[model samples]
Target: MKVLVIGATGYAGHRIATALRRRGHDVTGLTRDLAGAGARALAAAEIRPVAGELADPAGYREHLWDADVVVHTAMDYADPAGSDRALIAELVAAPRHLVYTTGISLHGRVDTPELDEESPSSPDNPLHFRYQLERELIASGLPHTIVRPAFLYGHDSRTSQLGRWFAAPRFVGDKDKRWSFVHVDDLAEAYVRIVERADAPLGDIFVIGEENPPPALEVFTAAFRAAGHAGEVTVHPISPEEWLEQAADQDERVNSAKARRELGWTPRHAGPIAGMATYYAAWQAANA
Candidate 1:
């Protein structure tokens, strides 16, 4: 199948794009510019990266027009209200099966440890606007599915959430906070399966998360040691206000039971406990 990934250069998007290509799908990755580190990463991954901007549909309309599936994993998207509205309008008009990527952070400060796809929505999150965008896509009667993936890791240790462990004397987070850590490779495979399989029904929500939700301190402590850091990996208490401002505490433990049961997506890494070491090795090689 021909696939068009809008955020092909992004951390999540790049991984998913590489996964799709590995599956032998004709994939085209859309990037705003074909320069700098992102381009190098795409090349190293053997993904076909095209210079296309998500903000301007006209620039990427040709690629989108020809793709059988369009997966949007773009982050830090342009001006939320206006840009998203226009982008959604164009997407709905495309008449293609669209898979929109969202994050577990949308669950937002949930105190529960085993939240699922049916859990209550967050009152506020940085990606709260995507909820509205999701609604618009489904309401448009387009064949689309939403993927709310867990905290992403792997590929680049420094790019991972646990990255602070390497440089900082101590990391900050509530010890009580737990997150369903998802390896980027596993999450990417989930996307490929969702797009390739006909069983992934429209308007359905699937979580790309792990069954094992690890505490923040435990995960980072392993990461700290993996990074060859000294002293204890400090776990500081972050205020709700601080979390809201910086999106620091995205600690909502979630389960991908539906995905596992239906889509047969089994995440490889349960958490950062062991993967951190492997990722650190990769980070060292890349930085060296």
Candidate 2:
């Protein structure tokens, strides 16, 4: 299959592009700056690059023209409205499947341990605009699917809550505040599978992640110790209000069983807890 991935330079997009290539698909990664486009990563995956701006239709149209499927891995997209509308128009005109990458944060501040798809939608999340628009478009009868993935972690992933533990004096969350994460490769597989089966009456929303969600502090402390941080790991429990204020503005948890059952998608990474040590080792090496 031929596919075009927007934001292929990002942490998630890069891994997704590689997963598609490994599965024998012809992948073109769209990037604005080819110079910093993780050339080494793309080459390793055998995926080609298409330099262009995602917010501009003309810039992306050339690359989207003949793609069998367009998996949009872009996030905090500069022009989410315009880019989504334009791409939806393009994909609808050609009748190709389009996958929009959303986050669990769309569900709003998670004051609890877990949230499934049945959880009531949050009308108050400040980031709800784009997700709402994308949901509206998917319901507009266009060939589209919404993929809401949780904290993404994997190869060449420059950012991970676990990765932060490599640095000492890391702010560990309450010892039992749980969060979910998905491997980038697994997310890419889910995207590709959905695109391939586009004709099978696909779903409108799919969350991707491992079944296990670990306590935030435990995960980070393990990473800290693994990274050879000599200082004793500390757990600082913050109130929900304080958490919302201190933590980076993003979602905390997501459910992935829908995708697992429908698309046969299952994350290969050992969820967040098991992967902490590995992430710490990688982080330490990279930083050293």
Candidate 3:
């Protein structure tokens, strides 16, 4: 299968492109620059890079015309509408198997419990325009599967929840504040499996993630230990009335039973704490 992957430079997009290529699918990375980070990270696959941004659908026509499936994982923080509109337009014309990425944050930070695909989504997060773009796409009724993943963590991911604590030594309220997350590799495979299943229903929504997410305090404390520090870690518990001030409130916790049954997907790694020591060791070697 010839696959077209947009935002091939992002955390999820890069992983999906690599996984698809390894599965023997010919991949074309659609991005602003073939020589940029996303393309560079995919050096192992040596995928062909199309030097066009998603905001310019006309530029992606040649690449889109040749794809058997399309996975869009890119985001334009500055102008999400433009990029999203472009991608939707392209999909409307060529409605092959399509997968779009969204985050659990759209549902706001839920700390009391974890949320699933069926859980009520806030969709009114104060972040930016991308959530609005997601709303538009869902209503468009294009043949596609929308994947909403919890916080995604993996090696070398600077923006991940774990990475932030490791790189910066700060603690949010209540270290035991629980949350769910999916590893980058696992989330990548979920998209691949979704695209492979031609018999799956249209307008499908799958929450791709591991079932047992860890608590914030415990994971960060272990990370500090891995960094050779034993400072008295604090677990600042956010007040019930102050949940909105917290970073992530995805308390309902995400589940992947549907993906596992329908897409044949499973996560390889457990929660981040289980492998904190191992990841820290690798971090030392890579940063050294």
Candidate 4:
């Protein structure tokens, strides 16, 4: 299968593109810079890199139309909703097997002990725009699968915030706030399975994460020790108003049984606590 991965130079997109290539698919990654470090890394991995932008579909329309599957992992942090809305509109016109990346943050503060694909989006979810995007994609009648990955970690993922936390270990808002996590390599495998079974059905949602989640304090402390930092992690308290505005104060433990049972996707890495040392080392190498 020929696959086109947008934002292929990104943290998750790069890994997903390489995994598809390793699975014997013809994979091309759309990157902003062909001569940048990320594009060079893609070339080193034997994946072709093409220059393009998500905000401008015409620049990458040919690549989009040429692929058997189009995986969108690029997101504009400054205007995430706007960027996704435009991309989805373009995708709706040229339908293909699409794998869209969403995040557990969309679920917001879950009242339940464990959130899953079926969980309802919290009313106060700050990223409600993402839910709107998901609805738009589903209603577009496109054959697409939505993947909501838990907090992504490992392999130099800045999303984990471990690198900064290692330098100054601290917890914002709630120390006991639990969050689910998935290794980047393991998340890439989930994408591989989803793409391989593209013919199955549309509108399937997968929450990709490890089985159990740990509190923020524990996870951070373990990472600090793993990075050879010997000190107590500071706890920063914030008002409920402040926390609610951020929409990240509540626990976000997730269940990935759906991905495991349906996509036959099993996460290979142990949780973040178990692989802290290896992950810290990878982050250092990438930053170096």
Best by lDDT: 4
Better of 3 and 4 by TM-score: 4
Better of 1 and 4 by TM-score: 4
Candidate 1 segments exceeding 4 Å error: 35-37, 40-46, 77-81, 167-169, 237-250
Off by over 4 Å in 4: 238-245
- Full-model lDDT for every candidate: 0.74, 0.68, 0.72, 0.83
Off by over 4 Å in 3: 109-112, 127-132, 235-247, 250-252, 286-288
Compose the digit string of candidate 1's lDDT tens values, residues 1-288.
999887888778888899998889888888777886787777787777788766677777878779899898885434655655565677677778888877677666555667777765565665566666777777888788889887777766444565545556365555667777788889898998898887556778888777656677777778777877767556666555554324536566777789988888897765667667787776677668
Model 3 per-residue lDDT tens digits across residues 1-288: 999888776667877898898888899887676666666666657677778867788787878878877788876766777778877887788766677887766666533355666655454544324456667787887777888887777766555666666676566664445567788888888887887876778788888877866665677788888878877876555465643334363353667787788888889888778888777765566457
Q: By the lDDT metric, which is better: model 1 or model 4?
A: 4
Model 4 clash count equals 0
TM-score of each: 0.89, 0.83, 0.86, 0.93
lDDT, candidate 2, 92-202, per-residue tens: 666766777876766665565566665544667666675677667766677767877777775545655555445544653445556677877778888778877735774
Off by over 4 Å in 2: 76-82, 110-113, 167-169, 172-175, 232-253
Question: What range of 10 consecutive residues in model 4 has the weakest lDDT sum?
Answer: 238-247
3 Cα displacement, candidate 4 (Å): 0.7
Q: Output the worst ten-in-a-row residue range by lDDT, candidate 1.
A: 239-248
> Which rank order by lDDT, best down to worst?
4, 1, 3, 2
